[model samples]
Structure formats: C-alpha cells, structure tokens
Target chain A: MGVLKAAWWIARKDLAVEIRSRELIYTAMFFAVACLLIFAFAFVEGRTTIRNAPAGILWITIVFSGTLALGRTFERERQAETLRALLMTPVERPAIYLGKLLSLLILLGSIQVVVVPLVGLLFGAPILRAPFMLMGLLALGTTGFATVGTLFAAMLTRTSSRDVLLPVVLYPMSLPALVGGMQGTLWIFAAEPNYELVQTWLAMLVFFDAVFLTLALWTFAPVMGE
Target chain B: MKLGDRLIVVLLAVSGLMLTASPYVIDTAPYEATMGLVQRIFYYHFPMAMTMMLSAIVCGAASAWFLFRRSERADHIAVAAAEMAVVFGVLTLITGPLWARKSWGVWWVWDARITSTFIMWLVFGSYLLLRRFGGAGSEVLAAAVGFFGMVLVPFIYYSVNLWKTLHPSNSVVPSLPTSMGIPLYYCWAAFTLLFVALMSVRIRLERSRGWLERAYRAVED
Candidate 1:
C-alpha cells in the first residue's frame, strides 16, 4: 500500500479501537476537566482574575492533560505487545509515526473541543470573537505537541520509567509551541486583541511545528531500532 | 596515568590556582559606575555561562556521533559532557541570580538569555535522568534527546529574543573596559582548561566502568 493509505489505515485502526473501548477518550477528558477545575481554584480569585489569565490557564491545562493522554495511548500499544508486531510488518516507519501522530491529534482535538468551551464558560474568554482563528492556533499547537509526543512515546515504549520520562522529555522540547500557543490564545482573549502579535505568534507555532515534526521523523527510525 | 593525562592534571591545577586568584584580580579592576563591587561576580559568572553553553554543544555533538556510529566512546563522551553541562549550568544558574539580585534588584527576571539557559539546563538534566532511569536502550534515547537539544539551542535563543525581556543583552567582551576585560579573559581561559580536564577525567571513568561491566558479564557467562 501507499504510505498515505497505510498511514490512514493505521490511524483508522487506532480510532476504531478507541471507539470500541472509549478508555483513552473518557479518561483524558476527565483529566482535562480536573486540570481546569484545579486551575480555577488555584488562580481564580474572582471573575477578573480568571478573565485576565484564561489563555495561560487554558494552555497549561492542555499541556498537563495532553502529556497524560500521550502516556496512556502509548501504554496500550506496549501492554499489548502490538508495537513490535506492527514494526515487523513491511509498513514504512515514517508512516507508522504519521499514523500515530494523526490519531493523537484526533484524541487531543476532542479534548480541546470540550475544554475550550469550558474555558470560555468558566473564564469568560472571548473565544467566540475569533473562533476560527483560535481553532487554527489550537490545531497548530496540538499538532506540534502530538508530533513530538508520539515520537518520544514510541522511543520510550520499552523503557521501565516511561511514564515519568515522557513528560520530562516532552515538556522542554514542546516549550516553544506552548509559549506560542499561549501568546496567540492570549491575543484572542484580549478585549483589544493585537492582530500583528497574533499573526507573529501563529507564524512561530507553524515554524516550530514544521521543524520539530521533521526532526522527529528523522529521529524516530533510529530511536525505535531493533 | 599516561603522560597526556598527567599534563591535563597539571594544567587543571594551574588553572585552579588562577581561578582562586581571580577574586583579587577582579577586585583590583575599576568598579562599574552603576553596580560597584557586586559586579565582580561577572568574571566568574560570564565564564561559567560560556562553559555551560560550550558543554551543551559538545554534549549534543557527541550525542549525534553516538547516533550515527553507535560507538561506546561516543556515548561515554556524551554522558560526560552532559554531566559537565549540568555542573556548569548549576553554577551559572546560582551566579546569575546573585548578579541579577544585585544588578536588577530582583532575584530572577525572565530575561531571554536567562530563560534560555534555564531551559537548556533542564534539557540536559532530563538527558541525564533518562540515561539513569530509562533502563535498557536508554543511551539511544538519551542520544536522541541530546540531538534534539542541540537543534533546540538556536530556536530557544530566537524565541526568547523575540519575546520581551529585562536582562542586559550587550556583548560583554566587545564593550568591556580594559580593566574588566583582562580579568574576564583570564577567567575564561581558566574555565575552559578546567572543563577540558574534567571531561577527560570523566571520560576515563566511564571507559573503566564499561570495561568492568563487560568483565563482570564475561565472568557471569
């Protein structure tokens, strides 16, 4: 099969399994909600406080829960011993990475769907003002997160301390994406949002995603060696 | 030890003495019009920062070599360089806050260089953590982290620069007065010598440990 088709097939497989089990989806959503509630309690002194800091809080929630989701998703493959089986197939390695990344993006995207609305409700963010732009920024940011996260998850699959190592490795590498996402989201939330600053941050997110995805692709094959 | 190892040890000793004497040298330099005596920390602070940056690059390069060659030597060098990076990074972190406290009137400020160095320090710290706790094939994974970290240095620098920050971003060497410049260079030379000496010794230790592991495995077999 062609690489694209093979990748789509693998992504479909993961989605089908997830649809059947609903284990990763339900747990990730619960975690994301829990994170939002904790942030609300910790930082939300009043309406003004939540309104002022919604973007930072939102992104932090996503990052923390996203790390959790990545770990759990990869744990399934490792537990089933399916990763080795999949590798033994003739499917291209990069295709496997892309497939995994795509599924993670879908998983994270669903979490965002619920979390973004809750952020708007709880923090009174002006998320609706620039809805499409905000979605674009979230998509870009999540793509970057999943791209690197999936690669690292694969690399750490055989490790004993994978749960701890995943976030430790992921967070520093994903800092630029997180910062850019937070900045863009902040712009979206502001009453007098600066178009110029938003654009610049969006461009940074794009650049980071492109560079890291390429690097992850190259590094994945070697890191996941026999 | 071999003649070269002895030479490195002697050079390390001489540089150690120079570093010890550096305080007096810095004291004699004309005080900055703005910061006064507290500015003397710059001599040690600046060199430690340089050594930390150099060690990061060296570690990254060694990691790349390990990825390409899969040689035990490259892995040893990478781990050794990472350890040194952490050591120097800690020194830089502590000295930077001290200087910042006196100069900026704050214990810490999210300045571009400061933030980048802190992030870089964390990256190397994680590199060491993965190696220690990752279990089988951890070196390969740590090597991957090193390679990504090397790639990240410039990105982190640019991103932090693009963001607004309060730290001074001037070129210290080019703008330095003669009085300050002399001691700064002396410290730089001494720190560089010390880095080389430490890396060599650490690499030797790693090699011996690897040999011992192999011998033990052979006996078990």
Candidate 2:
C-alpha cells in the first residue's frame, strides 16, 4: 500500500476499535474534566478566576490527559503483541508513526472539543475571541506534542517501566510546544488580545511542529529496529 | 599503561594544575565597578556553562552516530557525555543562583538562557533515567531521546528568548577587558580539559562493563 493510504488505514483501524469500545475516549475526557475541576478550585477565588490561569490550565490539562492516552494506546499494542507484527509488515515505518500520530491528534482533539468550552464557561475565558487563531494554535500545538509523544511512547513500549518513563521523557522534549501554546492562549484570553504576538507564537508553533515531526519520522525507523 | 589511561592521566594532571592556579589568576583580574568581587564567580560560572553546553552537543552528536551507524563506541561516548552534562549542569544551576543572588538580587529568573538550560538539563537527566530503568535495548531508545533533545536546543532557545530576557546578554565575553578575558579563557581551558579527562574515564569504564558482560555470557555457554 502507498504510505498515505497505509497511514489512513492504520488510523482508521485505531478509530474503529476506539469507536466500538469508547473506553479511552470516555476515560481520558473524564480525567481532563477532573483536572479542570481541580484547577478551578485552586485558581477560582470567590467570584473571579485567577488572571491567566485558564491558559495554563487548558494546556496542562491537555498534557496530563495526553500522556495518559499515549501510554494506554501503546500499552494496548504491546499487550496483544500486535506492534511486532505491525513492524513486520512491508509498509514503511514512518507510515506507522504517522498513523499513530494522527490517531493521537484526533483523540486529543475530541477531548479538547469539550474541555475548551468548559474552561470558557467555568472560568469566563474568552474562548470565542479569534476563533481561527485559537484553532490554529490548538491544532499545531497538539501536533507538536503528539509528534514527540508518539515517538517516545512507542519506543518506551518494550520498557519495563513505561508508565513513568513516558511523561518523564515526553514533558521536557515537548516543553517548547507547551510554552508556545500557553503563551498564545494567554494572549487570546487577555482583556485586549494581542493578535500580533499571537501571530508570532503561532509561527513558532508551526516551526516546532515541523522540526519535531521531521525528526520523529526520520528516527522512527532506526529506533524501532528495522 | 594503555594509551587511553596515559591520556587520561596527562589530561587530569594538566587540568588539575590549571584549576589549582585559577584562583590566583582570577584574583589578579580587575574587579567590576558595580558588582565588585561577586563578578569573580563569572570566571567559574561561565566556563561551567560552556562545558555543559559542549557536553550536551557531544552527547547529541554521539547519540546520532549510535542511532544511525550503531557504533558501540558512540554509545559509550554518548553515555559519558550525558553524565558530564548532568554533573556540569548541576554546577551551572547552583552557581547561577549564587551569582544571580548577588547580581540580580533574585535566585532564579525565567531568562531565556537560564530556562532553556534548565530544560536541557532535565532532558539529559531524563536520558540517564531512561537508560537506567528502560531495561534491555534501551541504548537505542536513549540515543533517540538524545537526538531529539539536541534538535530541540535551538527551538527552545529561540522561543524562550522571544518570551523573556532578564539575564545579561551573550556579548559579555567579546566585550571583556583583556585582564578579565585572560583569566576567563584560562578557566575555560581548565574546565574543558577536565571534562575530556572525565569522559575518557567514563567511556573506558562503560567499555569494560560491556566486555565483562560478554565474558559472562561466554562462560554460561
């Protein structure tokens, strides 16, 4: 199969499984809600929410639940010994990596669909301000995060202590993306939104996603042991 | 003695001599008008920072070599360089706060260089942790980690720099007076020599451990 076609099929396979079970989607969304509630308690004072808290809370909730999802997604592959078989296929390894990244982006995207509005509703963040810019930041930021996360989580699949190692490895490597996301969202949530600064941050996010995705693709083959 | 051992011995001796005389050398340099004696720590602090940066580069390059070429020697070098990064990173982190305490009246600042350096330190430290607990076939995994960390260096630097900058800029060395510059260069050489010597020892130790493991397997057969 062609690389893009194979990637689509792999992504479809994962989505089909997820659609049938709804386990990861349900759990990860609940975990994100729990994180939002916990942070609301800490940041919401009397009637007013802490200034700039929503930006940090939104990005952090994504990161935490994203890590959980990355771990379980790979854990499932490892459990059935399907990853080895997947690797044995004649399809290119980059295709496998792309497929995994796509699925993760979708999974995280769905969770955000709910979490973003909740943040705006509960904390009065101006989520509707510059909707396109917000979506661009979210999409690119999630891509950057999931690109690195997928590579590391896939590599960590065979390790004995994966659950702990995934976050330890993923967080530092993906911090630039997280910072860009938070800062962009912060600008959006500001009383007077700075579109110029938001543009700058969005540009940085694009750079990060491009560089990280390229590296992840280039290294996936060797790291997975061809 | 083996060539590696002799090299290590010579490097250690020379660097030791340089380090021993560094205090006097730094003392001879003129003090600053604003910061006075606290600026002296810059000699050590700056060199440690350079050495740590060098170590990170070396680790990343070595990791790339190991991942693509599967060179065992490269793997050994990567491990040694990572350890050096962590050791020197800790030194830089500690001395930074001390200097900042005197210079900026604060322990830590989210300055571009400081934040990126801290993140790099965490990544390298994570590299070590992954190797320790990752079990079998972790060398390749750690190599991937190192390579990714290396590529992220410039991105992180640029992003953080654009965000905030409270620390002194990077042009201090070029603008330094000759008297101060001489001592600063001297300390840099000493720290670099020491870094090379320590890396040699660590690489040798790692190779020996590999040999011992292979020999044990031979006996089992």
Q: Evaluated with lDDT, which candidate comes out highest?
A: 2
- How many residue pairs collide in each prediction? 0, 0
Question: lDDT tens digits, residues A98-139, model 1?
Answer: 898898899899989999999888877888988878998899
What is residue A184's positional error in candidate 1, in angstroms? 0.5
Please give each candidate's TM-score. Answer: 0.95, 0.96
Q: Write the per-residue lDDT of candidate 2 for residues A76-186, one digit (tens) a residue.
A: 999988999888878999999999988889999999999999989988999998899999999989899999999999999999999999999999899888888888998
TM-score of 1: 0.95
Q: Tell me the tens digit of each residue's lDDT in model 2 across B48-167.
A: 999999999999999999999999999999999999999999999998888887777788877778899999999999999999999999999999989889889888888788766322
Model 1 alpha-carbon drift over 4 Å, by segment: B165-180
Candidate 2: list runs displaced more than 4 Å. B165-180
Error of 1 at A6 (Å): 1.9
Q: How much of the real interface does each model capture, measured as fnat?
A: 0.73, 0.79
Q: Rate the local accuracy (lDDT) of all candidates.
A: 0.86, 0.91
